[model samples]
Target chain A: MREFFERLGLMAEKAVVTTGQIIIMLFQAVYYLFLPPFKFRNMFKQMEFVGVRSLFVVVLTGSFTGMVLAMQGYNALKRFGAESLVGPTVALSMARELGPVLTGLMVTGRAGSAMATELGTMRVTEQIDALYTMAINPVKYLVTPRIVAGVLMLPVLAIITDFVGVLGGYFVGVKLLGINPGVYIGRTIDFVSVNDIFYGLTKSAVFGLIITLISSFQGYHASGGAEGVGRAATSAVVLSCVLILVSDYFLTSIMF
Target chain B: MVKLSAEAKVGIFVLIGIILLAYMSLRVGGMRFGKEEGYTLTVKLDNAAGLDRDASVKVAGVEVGRIKDIKLQDHKAVVVLRIKPGVRIGRDFTAALKTSGLLGEKYLELIPGSPNAPYLEEGEEITRVRAYADVDKLIADLSEVAVDIKKVTGSMAKVLGGEAGAASLSNIVSNLEEITYNINAVVEQNDERLSTVLANLEVFSDSIKEVAAGLNVLIKENRDDFTAGVTNLKAAMETLNSMAPEIKHTVSSIQRIARRIDEGQGTIGKLINDDTTHEKLNRTLTGINSFIDKTQRFRLYVGYRGEYLFDADDTKSYLSLRIQPKADKYYLIDIVDDPRGNRRTTKTEVTEGGSTRTVETTKTSDEIKFSAQIAKRFGDLALRGGIIESTGGLGADYYMFKDRLKLTLEAFDFHKDRNPRLKAGAFMYLNKYFFITAGYDDFISDVGLESAYVGVGLEFEDDDLKYLFSSVPPISF
Candidate 1:
């Protein structure tokens, strides 16, 4: 029991230290955003790759998720003669929670893991060392653009997801179920509010920051050759997903 | 020159991604940098489901503004909406968040108040807002109501068929069957009558059209005459108004007479109100029937002897009577006797026999035999029983009276039958009982026909009995 208590104390200490480090990192990011010698071109290029290129996959996943949600909600509500409420059910779920979280997870798997692997490979090949020797700041040159892109791209992806998900719900709810389109849309609007969308975008933005930081941190600390780089890529994805879920709850509690 | 390496490619990709995000943010996120040409308004809501900066704002379903900012102040959400110039709201405008489509992004919607009201100023806070009515809770409540309704209906079905119910179902079913048969018969009998009525209606419609045309012609030809008639009516009304007090006095006298009759104070009132009059009438009718019976018997007895004398000639000496009477006219009666020198003649007569006779002679004529008879007749009359009662109260009482009084009218047994019946009458007091009391009493019995009675009553009051008369106006006339 003493050992267990000691372990708990150590774990608590580690948690505090990690929380402090994250806070410092957040402050650094905000500070860097407004600093001189800003890399606008790099930021723009990263945004295109992350935001524009990932649009189709995000929309596809979002629409299917919405259709599946409607089907499930309809089945449950129909038992109680409340199938008409499916519209608001789908709308509120997507706008408040699923739209942001799902888009973050998808982009993290698609782009976050890829970013870590590319950077890890560069580190193993001594490209990062070469940049250091040339007196260029590696954080600014290698990390800033990707960080900016991830942070900015996520909200756009979330918006697209929200739009496509609604359309998917409409297809299933109206076309398939023969519900009046006007009533479905009216109920959706009536049930959903402005705060739900705002909360989702805010969550997406935070998730973007976490993904970029995890991928870059894992890549920067990579040591072993090919095997080590592969491990970093995998670990980056897992950590990013965990952080996203944990942060989502906290953000929701605070916003709501 | 160094060829672009994998690191550079990745770097460039990241840069591209950043630029694309910025562009999307500006385009799709509805981000605006410069001041827009609009008036800004703020609203505080307890909850904001999915609103954000740059969200579109609509008025009357038209895009009139966009959300500028959303922030929490004092634990409440403050939303700043930038409305377009020339789009006006009122003090009573309601702000609500609406989704564009199912699961779509939410936008701020402003419901404009009355147009005639003063417009809201720039930067004014809109206080009225409608929060989302929780769809899940509403659905739950509706389902609960439906369950309650089902339960009530089920209970009602059980009560209607229980042992102690108002009617035996079997009796009701038989009555229903009889009613169905009667309805079918009536429908069959009225088929030709209905066709005649339809024909008459068509003719009436044509006549109405003709009348309308004739009226139009008359109006065109006698416009002056019509105006003169109207003028004359107006003058007559004026003259009546000038003599109103005298007319009112005359009307009051007539009303007093009516009130006396209605209160059972005079002969007509007693005839209407007293049950003894009905009993006396019934006894009188019975006595009349008995008297008619005695008179008919006297006539029959007087006519009977004439037939005996007519057939006397055919008999032998010693006054033997032979009578052959019509069967339908009289009851059967017979007599036989014999009288002769040494051979006796015997005769037999029947009151109901046909006109045929035979005579025979006997050697021993010393013994004499005689026969006499009498008959009685009866008539058909049906008896019926019923009870009637009336009660009288303005305003809601009038409406109640109209409904209840009509029920009484459906109770009277004009054609009596062998059935027990009940009848009730209701009268409404209108204008403090100075108004008329109308009542109807209908006999409730299974007599295959409905009988109804209607009567009007008036009430009176003196200083000593004013309160009693006012409260309990007698409802019979």
Candidate 2:
């Protein structure tokens, strides 16, 4: 029983420290964001890496997700004789929930894992310590740009994803299933408002901050050589994905 | 070996992202840029349920603006709206707070007013507003009504389910069945009487058929007479119709005359109104009254006759006068316009071809003439000898029933015709001045114009008739 209590205590302590570090790191990132010995170059480099490179996978995931939504929505709504609602259904889902959440997960798997691994490997090899000896703050040099890039790039990626998803929904709804084109488009415009898209974008931006923070924190503290980097990368992906999904429900309730 | 600049690649990537951001913000967030991009409006509401900044403002379900900011003011919520360019919101537009769906999103719905009105200017407040409906209150009211209905129906069902009510219902149904049965029985009992009625109806139909057949024969036999009667009716109707416009004109003229007389306007008006002319009329009327009272002194009779000849298809008219010299003696004079007076004909036919021959002949002569005669009455009979149509003739008259009926005989035109043309007729008095005369005209030897004729004439005192004639407008022709 003592061991179980100790284990619970250890878990609670770890959670608190992690949350505290994330908040501190967010503040430092924001501070650095303005005080830019502005690595506009580094920010752009990271943006290319985060947003441009992820476009194909994001688009593919988004369109397929939307097509499946239309198919399922048609069947469900057909029971109620409201088959024309498929467009609004697919568009709303992509804009309000799926676009941000799915983009967060996919980018976590692609860029978040890489960020953790790269930073972790540098730490284990004493590169960060070397930077400190040169009187350079490693966080400023490395983590800030990635954080900024993630925050900036994620919303853009989600917007692209939403566009593709609506296209896919249109192809499936109107061409494959013979839903009225006017009703499909008109209902989407009618129900899926600007607020819903803004909600999605805000969620994506927060997801970006969470993803970079978790990955960078894990990497910056990483100690063990190769195993620690690998561990850090896996945990980064898993934590960010979970955080994305968990935060989504709260954001929807509060924002809507 | 690497020549590419990382900055350029990153710049392009960032540029694309910025472009996408612009597209996304404008398309999805409905955001715009620039200082004077869109117009701003203010609206105040009593209650703005579930509304916030950036809530859409729609016209006819199409979004044209959005809430820029919402603030609390003097016990009310005031909203500032930013409308897109070219979206006309009339001054009288109504702003209704509406929901996208039940328990879904809420928006400001602006229903436009008439199109011709001036637009609501920037910064102007929209006066017409509707608050969002409280669905919970509505549902509560509906439930209350439903509860009342349920109570009423429950009592009704209880009343209908009672033992006595059921017995009454069953009895009523049985009574209805008995009534229908009695009706059927009565109908069966009257079957023979219904048949007898039907047989009498058949005999009545036969009698109607016989009457229709007799009418058909009568119509066939008198078809010519009916045609003549219809022709006469048509001529009379034509005359009356032709006189209608003239009569209307005359009526208007008479109205003018009456008005003129009232206004004392022209000679007739002067005659009626002037004392001298009035005195003259009064004296004439008095003299006529005195003469009528002294009818035994000069008992003269005057008559006018109009006759229609079927053979000649013409009319003959006459004026007759009878002067009483004593209580039993009288003189008669007549003026006649005869359609058939005399006839002459000459015929010549060429015996050889191409030989010229001509003949002139007179078939008939029409003229006006006067005839006079003297008669002495002995009780109800009179003997007379005089000229008839300017030739010698004699007549005897038998009067009956105070001269209401008279039979007369005349022989005239002896030198002109093959045999003396004789006329025999009886006069039947119909009224004070009218009589009907039917005569066998020129039937003595049938060589002259012979006809069985019928005519009507008027007989009255000569002085009375002469006075009436003088009062009328003179016939010019």
Best by TM-score: 2
lDDT tens string, model 2, A12-45? 9999998998788778877877884777888777
Assess each model's interface with DockQ, reporting 2 decimals per model.
0.03, 0.24
lDDT of 2 at B410: 87
Complex DockQ, candidate 1: 0.03
| Candidate 1 chain A: worst-modelled 10 consecutive residues by lDDT | A21-30
Off by over 4 Å in 2: B1-5, B17-477
Worst 10 residues of 2 chain B by lDDT: B468-477
- Best DockQ among the predictions, by candidate number: 2
Candidate 2, after superposition: displacement of residue B218 in Å? 24
lDDT, model 1, position A193: 64
- What TM-score number comes out for model 1? 0.39
- The fnat of each candidate, in order, is 0.00, 0.40
Q: How do the residues B76-133 of candidate 1 rate in per-residue lDDT, one tens digit apiece?
A: 9999988888878888899987886566678888888887877879889999999776
Q: Comparing only chain A of model 2 with the true chain A, what is the TM-score?
A: 0.97
TM-score of each: 0.39, 0.49
After aligning candidate 1 to the native by TM-score, how far in Å is the CA of B120 from where it should be? 18
**What's each prediction's clash count?**
41, 0
